[model samples]
Target: MSGWSDSGWGLRMQSWGEKYNQSNLGSPDCVSSSDTISRPTLWAEPSPVVPKGADVTLRCQGQRGRNRFQLWKDGELQEERNTSWHLAEFVLREVDDWRDARSYRCRSGQGPLWSELSDPLALVVMTGDFPKPSIAVSPSPSVLAWTTVTIQCQISSQQSSPDYNFALLEAKSLQVLQLQSLSRSQPYFSLPFVRAEDTGSYGCIYYRKTPPYKGSHPSHTVKLTVSGPLPKPTLWAQPGLVVAQGTNITLWCSRPSLASSEEVTYTLLKTGTWQPLRNQNATDLWTDFSLPSVRPEDTGSYRCTYKDRTASGAQSETSEALELMVTGSLPKPSLSALPGQVVEPGKHVTLQCRQPLQPELWRATFILLKVGSLQPLQSQRPVGTSAVFPLLSVRAQDAGNYTCVYKKTFFHQVSEPSDVLEIWVTDASPKPSLSAWPVSEIASGTNVTLLCQGPPWTTRFVLHKEGSMDIIQDEAKFFLTRVTSKHSGRYSCSYQLGTNGSLWTQHSDPLQLTVKVSSNTLLITLSCVIFLLLCFLLLVCFCHQYIPRAADFRGNSFRRFFCCSCLSQDVCLSHHLEDPKEETLYTEVAKERPKESSVPIDKDVTYAHLNIKNLNERQTNPKETSTEATLYATLSLD
Candidate 1:
């Protein structure tokens, strides 16, 4: 048997064309009797590659109006059809005989005069078991609606010919989606802007392009799923989705109230990705998709779906979107605590985060991160130079290592992490005891030592002056050397159990210190008192020696008078000393004409005495006797 390309088929077509031209004697609708009809197109329905027992339709396409079509195989007419339509189709039944693998052609005309033979259409029958071609989809098999999807059919390089024909068929209906005669350069079938209607299982087949066209077995089916149909599955992340770089997390995909016996599989989907990010088979209703050490590139919106393992392969709707953020793009911010990192319970503490002061960082959100937590503890925009997070009435559980970062609204860019700031919250019970050495009241130019006593486990001590931000740390003693008036204030002290521990004992009672006169001034005041005492003693001795009448007088009367005079002088001197404006001494001498004649007037001796007088007033005494003659003298030391 000869094929369509054999010389026999060419001669048969040539003779028919000559005879048809000769017999076209009178045709009213024909433009001219010598005019020859145009050659038609012949092609196989579905594809040239067919299964062993499958039937295929051969179509001859030509001009309209009672077109006469003839289908030939191996240069012999197999069938003919006369129809008013532009094309005629003939069914080839049970193409199982490998011996009948031959070329096919068709022709169409008005009648006696026929058009030239159409191009040869090869018939491929699956007789020998040929290896199946591998099929794969670009990006992914599961696609979003209105996105382009590509199906690639791949065979071995040895099997790849110049004109290999590839056909993509839907598995359910066994309908060909696309058929292309391709070279090695173009081997894939593309479905542009696919929709929900395009969702189904698909397979591909390949065949030789020439006569005796051998066909390969169908490839494994690939399920094409378009999202948004079926019931949506629930998706959540374990340990949270927002994570730092290198953090591991799991995405859970589950169908609500799913039957325990139903086999299910889960798929993880990320936005902007055409294929499923991950797949997992589950014996139960849910499955976990673990992403270990995720990077910045992994940050995106994610969703999940659950599909039954049944024959229908029904897939559930996509879950609500969850955002995965991997921060570390900008620069880490600084974190600090107000008051101190170690705080007493019942006290309010503020955590301040200072972000980089870049022009693009304005209004950037600051996030407070805890070491063991997957989510941010708090977030805020900077109000001033730094973002402040207040922890009111802080409890013991609030103690932990924390960091901070800033995120810009532009592209959601995040900064690197700041240094960790650990907050310690304790009861600060069993208050320490504070005491001052010597005295709380210290004069200037003296050392004031404060001692703090705490539990036996204490390793460090701290002294805090009231209304002061300066903190003085020491072992047990805090010394203020050469303290001035500025150091005179209320002070308190606390102790720490360990050298590096953030916990602290409650502050001790405040000790107030009063600083007085300087050491030099105190010395001067003592010298003045000593000098005054010496002057008084010298005056008393001089008066006793100068009075010679004291030995002559046998009676106690004169001695008493002298003693009384001396006592009165003491009172006058004390009065004069109180005058701050002037320093003056007044002397009065009483000369007695000797109540006894033996008491001669010691004219060679002078008597020194003190007289009491008011400077603002002067008076003259008229009663004057030799026994009470008074002489007055004044001395002034300015």
Candidate 2:
């Protein structure tokens, strides 16, 4: 009788009791349990779903004794075999026809009344037209050893009518690795902590639960490749990792020179994502992935991996991460210099980059850029709204036009560049020569030229005035037209060299300029001089009235003369004058009490006289002796 079993093998067995009851009712071949040997058990090898043109074997086992086994198919007696042992075997060789996919039963006994038939087994042959299921793998097919992997055997919904049973098998040997039955849910086989032994191609098939016990064709094979430690490839960027907006850049993934395979597939993956950004097949050891006109969205940390087209399909370890930065995405920051942009060579200065105060950019990194530099000079994290880059002991090479930007670390969003700030480092070189044209001191409303001469390489000149905050930058010569008192101060000059005039020399020695009144006031000054000269001549005449003999005057040697006149013999003189050689003296006389009295004199004295003796001896040249007579006088007033 046709029957069904939940066990995947589709076992349909008839018990000895049923056979005995049927014999008592009509059949003579069956007997009671006391008179008949116990029923034997029958089973099939491998499975009932035999591949076309393949062989299948059925085995029957009974109580230990010599036994004769009879095989029945379609209720008809088929081939039978005898065995001296407890088990008998039947082989259906070359199961290649549709008729071979039928149910069969077997029994084993020594006598004519054989034991009851063993369970019926459905031999479901694999028809080429059977529905084929698909296989998929989780994670990746190629993984490091000891990684858990799940292989799923999925069938179409149309195949869901009959309860399905799934078997995962080794593709090479067709050996069953896992078997499971499912009523409605899909089936999957998990190889936990898979090892090297589990690495191979695997396939799966599904069969129905009941008779006609059909099985679908095997699904496509999935290769599970397990590998040991693999050498890591190298990743790098061409033209550097930091680039400007809309700049083309290439990322290279290169395998080791000693790698065994030349045919390789390279994958570039950015961090925080599992999917590859690009894939390339290359015959060479290295492959390039070009990102043209890269934007800020392309900035991230990326790594690359390569798969060798070897027999095992081995995968290399992931390459080291490379960070790419794209500038000019956000609003620009403002740049400034502390302690001024003109710095001394041995001093310290700071460049401050002030970022826009926004909540999204609080954790940005600031970068300092110098003109003509390939890479950023420095980077800093923001403190408050700005980041400060301290340049200590700056030298001439550090001087340049600098700009700044900020980037968000997480997103790699870069900000627009700040305005350029020109920095100058001052050196101890020879100072420039500072000179003024016309004169250092000049009257008001005059044009003045201050020339600063320095080395031939000097590109610019700076003029500074003492006690003034205004700085004048110009060429070597600074011209001041119609200068006023405001321009009268100590001035010094300095020179700078190199591109953008970043290097500066020490300041020159200071110069002072004096501004006086104009020519319009000269007449009043001359008239005042004439008035003083006439008064002096009148006073000398008054003193001549009190003349004394030169001999007597010579006696009063202690007296001081206020006026002295020299006259030649050929010139006219006053009547009080004596011989030219006498050396007359004039004086304002005071009453001396007849040369003995001590009474005070109230009259004012106009002059005092002094004597000269042996004047010839005092003459510097004997041949050039002077014949002129000298007059001495003292003028005083009460």
Candidate 3:
């Protein structure tokens, strides 16, 4: 409006007509042209980044012109203007960002002497991606093996027709794993049937489609983890996780019915590291990894994974973590169900747990537990590792599993649970039984141990010899470190409940611990040799009798009884029972016994007489009787 008026209308019309013809002419259009024309330069305000449906300005500027300007988009006429200053700006409104209607050019004229068209300028529409696109996995970072997952990569720019491409890469290995290109219609990728190897962190990048095709920096990394498919094993720590220094505890890893009878190997793993703590191949129902002694450094989270020969021989999924909160400053003590593990209903049961400790820890606070329960049943600050929890008149409900732990009042540190112990309150805690080993006529001097066995529930025991009740024992086995004749007395044992030692059950049936003199090997050998010599002499005498002596020399009935009795009374009594008059002792003794004595005492008769004598002596003095056989000397003056 401010420039020259239309007073040059005739000239302007002539100029417009001539300029329009020149505008059509280009370097490519002319084979050989006449007049040279100076061209106006064309450019866009913001290069290559025009947004869709946003207004854009294409300007053509040069020396003051005839004020006639025209704009063309991608070889098509857009608009024309008669302008004011030496510059002409053609405003393009509502231009589509991705609609290829972008390339533009302009021409300007000053009557009759018009300039050729300006250079073509291209505009690219973009929203964002000035930096890079961000990619993220849907659902969660952790996914189960063999499941589908979705990863969405998003750039701020939403181009109608995208000219930028995106590439997804694995951040872990820095591998170029393209999920999908941003230039594509869809930017999100679905990972179907994911696997262990698929677990890793990922990132995405965007690049231009134009020449040079520049690429932006990678996006922030996203983590994805895939867990294997397997039944997790059960993990429980014996003597518990929080423990004292030098305390031995076992971590039991169990996969019951699944293991069948085949042996399985179990490995215990700690968090923050791929390495395992220990492993053991177990043939039994469960495998155990023993921490023979734990130190403060051993505290951490623990889990167990195992592999068996059968059903999915591969290692199982890692079990849930069991936090080991070791505190050496805390006190640890042993736990036991005392008097015994089994107690009769209406009997006092004492759970006594103790561990040896220094005198400094005598006042440690103790806590007893019926596992799976949070509250401890017994809490006492005892003097020493020993903690006694007594239940009076225990009922069936009182019977269950129990364990204990200790803590110091000052630091509030706690020890781990002790080994599991069971309290079995049953129908009249049955009396324990007794038995001897070896099942033989025990040789004197050889060590003989009488086992006093009770139920697993019972703990305390007292053993009594038949004659002496004053001697008592706390152990189940009564070992006569050495045995003599005096030890041949009946023994019985009694057990009780409660640490208070207020009550006891009936005594076990008596078991006699017998010792014998027959154990003397040299005496036995000498007796055998003498008997053989006597037999030979008797044979000679008998043969001599056949030559010239009386009938009394050839046969004497008591001979058998006398000769066998010389060995030992126990042997004599045993043989005497088989027959009264017919049983003989030795062959020589049977031949000479009647000749030696005027009384015709058979083997049985002699045994009966000896039994009578022993009975008499026992009744009178309670002392063992000694027997002697009278041997008469037949002296021949020859």
Candidate 4:
């Protein structure tokens, strides 16, 4: 009976299996419960869990009835193979607090018969907050009141989200003073008009508020300091003095007690022109501008200003204004003489100086100096345009160089001195007149004296002849020995008051002299006397040799009687006695020969006899005694 009961139980278990098998075979989707076939299945499983920076692994297992299986994680399938189970293992290489707290899962499958999804598991990545953002303030070396300040924050992470927000906090109070959102890892913040109250210790904090919100720690702190305002500036002329018209004037701006590197600019207000006096980079402490050529038109009040740059790119207040007054032009002076001419020495002369157009507006002064001498003859402040120095008796010392100077109403300004005027006094000594001594022709080898006569009492004289000059200190004459023709020509003389006197009179007119040989007139007279005497003696001798004694006897009674008696008595008596007495008487008369010759006389004998007698004796001699005498008388009558 127990065997029959066991058999019945076995029959019942077989019948239940057969029915279960028939059901699986009829449903094709039930793969794992059906016959074993090689096919793939896919499903996911939970990821592995790990601490921060720890390594971890995940596994996916397949059922034995499946021929092939694949591992999956987060709905993504991994590599597959024909095996009873598929396994996937993962190692968490590094994890932070943020990453370790994330969720993970895994799955497995083979073809269409994939396994059910695995349960989800929490992953502890074990990460802390983001590293502190680096923060800095610009103009770190120094800070000033009312200046702009900039704050910069940065994060040194490549993976950080672009939507990170940053906030600057006062480190001492931990109060947020400023906030900013950044699309990049680093961002900058700026604040203008920073004052002393804004000075403090400051830092920055950053965070991301997207799907997963995270915060960052605060950065290192920086301290800020602030200073006071700039000082006031003052302006004035460098050297306080009256400036001449058309001259340059310089003004300076200064802040004696202030120390700053800020720039200074100057502006001069004159004739409606506002000139700029600064350059680029504008940090210079002083500036200068020439007035070029100042005039009365440039006279006005002047001022200066100093500017320091602010955080907002604006200017500061100006400095104090300075005042200046410019004066007018001065007068020009001149010098002249009262008579407007030079005077001779020993005569009265007056020297004068004339002030320019505005004489009454200026104080005039005069000075007269001899050139090359230190002492001035006259110096005075005249009342008007003209000043006179009346010299009672002009002398050598009175001739000199003269000059004039004058000043305007404003004593600080003066006019240029007048051009140098020269006043020369004519010399007093009279010029000596030159003349040759012995007022006749000069001869060679003889001493010649040249007399130079000056005004009665003159002491010194100078003689000039041809090319020669001689000085006669105490005398007024020049003597030359062995005078030659070469020494003959124009000669002149000059006289001075004294030997050493500078004054000298004008030269005298020249005197002319000629030189020749000596004693010509007497020699010519002697030659004429000798010639006349010889002619007279020859006439007397010619008369004596040719004249007849009978011509001579006609003028003398004694010689005439002697001749007649001889002829009548001797010759005629003898002849008559020889004749008869009657004839002898008549014949005697005829025989007497009429007391004259009937024979024609020779002209040579007549001329000779007349010539033989002396002119004085011929008138007294007897006549008619001889035939020659008769011829002579006839010749004389003819």
Best by TM-score: 2
Q: Tell me each candidate's TM-score.
A: 0.31, 0.33, 0.26, 0.20
* Tens digits of lDDT, candidate 2, 442-526: 9888899999997554668888898887355657888988988898999988887544455667789999978776776566777
Q: What are the clash counts of all predictions, listed in order?
A: 2, 6, 19, 50
- Give the alpha carbon lDDT tens digit for every residue of 1-638 in model 4: 11121221110112322322221111112312432333222111111222245554444344555444444433455445565434444444554545433333344455676655443333323124567778878877257877777778888876357566565655643433444567676777675656443444677776552312244656888766545434444556633222446667666554321122334334434324556443223444455545645565454445555444433232333455443333443444566665533457677767666666663554554444344543345666666666677777778766666655444322334444465766555553335677878763687668888888865536677787677765656678778788777777778888764334665678898888776654654566777788878876765454333222343433224333443344444543344235443211111113344555788756533332232334435567655333323132224322
CA lDDT scores, all candidates in order: 0.66, 0.68, 0.60, 0.50
Candidate 1 residue runs with Cα over 4 Å from true position: 1-257, 272-275, 309-322, 381-385, 409-412, 428-638
lDDT of 1 by residue, 381-482 (tens): 765547888889988778778887777654657777888887766563468888999899978889988888875446688888878874657578887899
Q: After superposition, how far is residue 275 of candidate 2 from its true place, in Å?
A: 0.8
Ranked by TM-score from best down, the candidates are: 2, 1, 3, 4
Candidate ordering by lDDT (highest first): 2, 1, 3, 4
Angstrom error at residue 574, model 1 = 83
Leading candidate by lDDT: 2
Model 2: what TM-score?
A: 0.33
Regions of model 3 farther than 4 Å from truth: 1-294, 300-328, 331-342, 346-403, 408-439, 442-638
TM-score winner between 2 and 4, please give it. Answer: 2
Residue 544 lDDT (model 3): 29
